[model samples]
Target chain A: MIDPSGWDLPSLTDRWRSATPFGHVAIDDLVARAALDELRQGVSKEPHWPNRGEIFEMMASGPPQQPTPRAFLEALGGPAVRDALAAITGYRLQRVDGNSYVYLAGSYLLPHTDHRPGVDRRIAYVYYLSPEGAFTGGELDLYRCTTDGSGDIVATEIAATLAPRPNRLLLFDVGLTTLHQVREVTGGARISLAGWFY
Target chain B: MLALHRDVLSTDERAQLRATLDAAGWSAHDLADRLHLATANAGADDALFARLLDLANRTTRPLRLRAFQWLRLRRGDYQLLKHDARERPPAAHVELIVDLSAAATGEAELVYTDGGATLFYVPQLPGSVAVIERPPALLRYQRYLCLRVADAEVHRLRLTLA
Candidate 1:
């Protein structure tokens, strides 16, 4: 579990500025090992909607029945994480909302922006539960966007591929130009806590 | 396999269509030529591509095939492709769509969605073209393709949206 007491965002603005392709940053060891292990167990056991298709996403929604997952999710949305996120992304996040995701083999999310109106979500974020190399092919692929003068959009080359690692936090500004995708998982499974910061 | 539809083109029309594709840079009927121009043209000739595809994809008048494009799925890869625009500001202008499987493949499907809720799904067939009429804005849809390398044929698919 993350303790927010005496929390200070360390060089958060500097790090985001140095990140290339887009304004984003990732940090490892975001949670204690014991707490993370518990979260993985709790999340894996939660009832997730296992809807499979070409453009795929399986969600384990909250309020969670599993104690560990519920605690971890709450901690992630708590002031500590929110404050860290706000400093890093420069958005006054009102709250965070998301569910656990399990991307097993054949599961993938297609490329698109997170620009749903009235959502009030400003920063897209994810925290991986599965250990690195535990799963294959679930890269958080980010893209470069080009817009015609009239607002027509075209996603160009991929600017970065952030691998889903345990205890790592991946966050980005959410907008029409912020295109990203979770590539198809070819083996095992990818478990993560994901949501948007408002 | 999906129920193959009545061939919309006559013998002469088919010949003329082939000539048109040849004149318009689609000389070869093989997989590579078709797949390349379809994806790589970058919409520079979208109208031309759409027009030629419409001719090849013509099903029946007033309900003609809207679009025709192909996909090549290799081993251990997704055989099925999404039917609509993968990006937002959906390319909903074209509606009459058809998908054709030219090589070895697995099961395919036509699923209809209403506000993300699936209303219906129809199994698709290989070596055949799948057709979709212009769905209402209330209904969203996409095609499902499952291809396998063990099928002993290259999975070649032609997709059309009207």
Candidate 2:
């Protein structure tokens, strides 16, 4: 269990800044389980496939579906997360969202980026619902987005993979550099809640 | 043989993949061309090189496939592709408007241009709605009016052509 009070956000900010292409986040089991429970009780429905990287995300939106609540977002959007965001862009956050996703067995997501030029959001954050050691082979993979102004997209993917440890929050800037994706789930169901802060 | 080798495919499997490629309107030469683009210094006609090309091209649409594939590939990566000022027609514009509203913690109207329907998110009823816009079968896209209630904060969403 993470004592949110004990979490020293400045240190966490250091970790995030030093985090390579793989990225660093704050997650604890209690926190992860709480987030998961919120997702489970929340409705599930078809998600909008808006662009190149929204396959698993489709299940979180649309009719009779469970959308994430402010409570869950509040839990993940602690002072540390906010501070980390501030450190990255040197700007205060106007709002944070808890965009939830629940994936049954065999769900997979391809590699891509989170920040587009038109959107006014900045950071991308995630909280893993499935506990570590509960399942096998659901690893979060990060990629580097290499592009020029002319719409040429080239992604050089890093091989480092992160296990879905509950309560751990994966956070990063969805700017011109960060490109990322989740590998296919090889075993049981995987659940997570993610969002961006404006 | 319990498991197949990673790079070296059995003779039967190799032939099967080759046939599948042909069915997909691809030739060994066509596959080679794709590989050459992915690889540096296109050394055409190298035997060792051809085997590597065949192995890589066997996979379908690795970059963009169904939803799961997209999630897996973007595990640690987060990005936003682009935004535009281009004017969208009623049908296409509604989807964009809904996506933006649903993206935040607010309330708004989702207009479905094709169907001339205005959808709202009522937390009490709390359900999803699919609106058929652009009636003729010729138009491919359909609009789904989605109301996402997060944290007691409700958002009205729509999906239309961009």
Candidate 3:
């Protein structure tokens, strides 16, 4: 259900390549209004568990089992969506997988590049589903990195911060320099369907 | 495996050590998302080292101190498991962490894991110490010090023995 008007391959390609700190593009109203509502309702009913680790603390759902979310994910992996993203980002993406994430009060994800050797992840995407004014402080922070001669990250500084606005979709290239994090959710819940385009 | 020794240091001893560390030169270690904390080299404290060594020999095995350091974590600081340098294969060592904070914050914790399952935990309790045996495949990390704990400070004396 991606809007065709905003999917202009030539313009999006330029924007993605020139984005600061790394390659990324943020598109508002990425999907039709009706589909967004259906996806949100379906995701709210899915079972979620507290997923925590050294770098992250948040609630996460497994792969979608409901019809609506399942269908939405399938659509994303289909040729229409995949081809559009491939044209813009220039990554030879073959498939997509996703899960629903809920960042509640005090939840956060520290800075990390989504790069994992041999995992085949090419692009990372987040579709924000939090209603307008539903949350505060859960911004997506991108960091500009200073790497050594060996291409190892040694220092970093905040380059950009994207609010978790409803109906917004963020897609970015994943590599050694794509350092990003989710700022802590201070007040309300920040919900989204996030995963990788592999 | 882990063993907690509560009230290991008296109030005066804790205060003295805190003062010493407070006055020591610290080096900030930052790597974007992996870790952000200050560390300093602590001078040799023979009596305390001997006590910890004796405790470890009694609890786990005979070992000698390899190194020790002072770690200070303020708000918004953390050390992730992936960033721990002790993750080398065939891990064989015992680690001791002595909490020397001015007050107990109960926010930061040292967590040991194996194959993604938690094996041991050490909380930030003033005057308490934790002795943990590092088996092969064992991983450890300090939980993030969140901003909600206003102005809370965590000072830990970490010792490695082999």
Candidate 4:
């Protein structure tokens, strides 16, 4: 059901294993165009709850119970996909948790290392649903952080940035150094399927 | 930064401190109703904070230490954050917050790519106070208090004490 029709997983996994800072991989046109269009339509129709907090801004919908979302989830949670991800990251794949975010203008996610106790989130991924160039200023910025002489966590600089494009999938492990934030959306809407493989 | 006064609070200052603490404890809802985002009137609260800071810093004062300890337990991660134009870090500032949980301890300093470094670490025990002296040159300076606790027991001491 995932329609992994485009990606060459073996090659992609190798690149991820050797990438800098920590292991991560990405691919564009991840889902088949027609299937994605249908999924987008189904996702847009769901009731969303607005999240307004110091650390996050955007609308969120719980994981789907219906078929469209179920199929998408099925693909991610499927054995082939899970095994490929595990082989790439050198971690066991027990489950994949999924949700979605709808970020409109002025919404942003501030910096935080997404490490919480009891949630053994090994890998985090985002499947872009919004078209590229349809919006501006919603790039995922990853920071290079270190504890300075004083013992405070200082984000020295932005090491990598990934712009959102429709049907692109981004996978990054939840390492101690994995500090990232979503820059404020200056205009229009940016939607994406967010998940974590644990 | 908290200005410490080694001298005891004057009668008038003590009365003011009691009144202010009582207002903060009782009229909290009323005050919140009138509060605006990112704005607060420190008023006499500054002096009280300075006094409390002074009391906590003097290791020899056990009575004052216990009082300050009680305040910390009652008020979780308590802080008075301000960004007045007059008291600000110079360009290349890093506002740092270190949480003061009873058993937690540590500090951090950041060095910019230019080789210039600024210290933003605060003492890591309860009642430790420090101020952000400048805004960072590259990124937005974040103002906050980080409360580090050793265990859940330390976090729930307020209930036990009450």
- Largest DockQ belongs to which candidate? 3
lDDT tens digits, residue span A65-178, model 4: 556776887889888788777767788888888887888876667655666678899888988888667777788877666656874543345677887888888888786557
lDDT of 4 by residue, B40-66 (tens): 122333454454444444522222211
Q: Model 2 chain B — which ten-residue stretch has the worst lDDT?
A: B65-74
Error of 2 at A178 (Å): 1.3
The lDDT of each candidate is 0.57, 0.41, 0.85, 0.53
Best by TM-score: 3
Is candidate 1 or 4 superior in TM-score?
Answer: 1
Query: What is candidate 3's local distance difference test score?
Result: 0.85
Pick by DockQ: 1 or 2, better one: 1
Task: Single out the weakest 10-residue window by summed lDDT for candidate 3 chain A.
Answer: A1-10
What tens-digit string does per-residue lDDT give for candidate 3 at A1-198?
664545778988899999998999988887788988988899999998998888888999999888878887887788888888878988878999999999898789999889998998898999898889998888999999998899877788989888778989899889978999998888888989899999
RMSD in angstroms between candidate 2 and the native structure over all alpha carbons? 17.3
Rank candidates, lDDT, best first: 3, 1, 4, 2
Judged by DockQ relative to the true structure, which candidate is superior, 1 or 3?
3
**Candidate 2 residue-wise lDDT, A15-130, digit = tens:** 77677764555434435456556555553333523221222333353222344444556644567646645764465877777655655544555455666788877777777765
Weakest ten-residue segment in model 1 chain A by summed lDDT: A53-62
- Name the better of 1 and 3 by lDDT: 3
Q: Model 3: runs farther than 4 Å from truth?
A: A149-151, B86-91
Off by over 4 Å in 2: A1-4, A22-24, A29-58, A61-69, A75-89, A145-151, B1-162
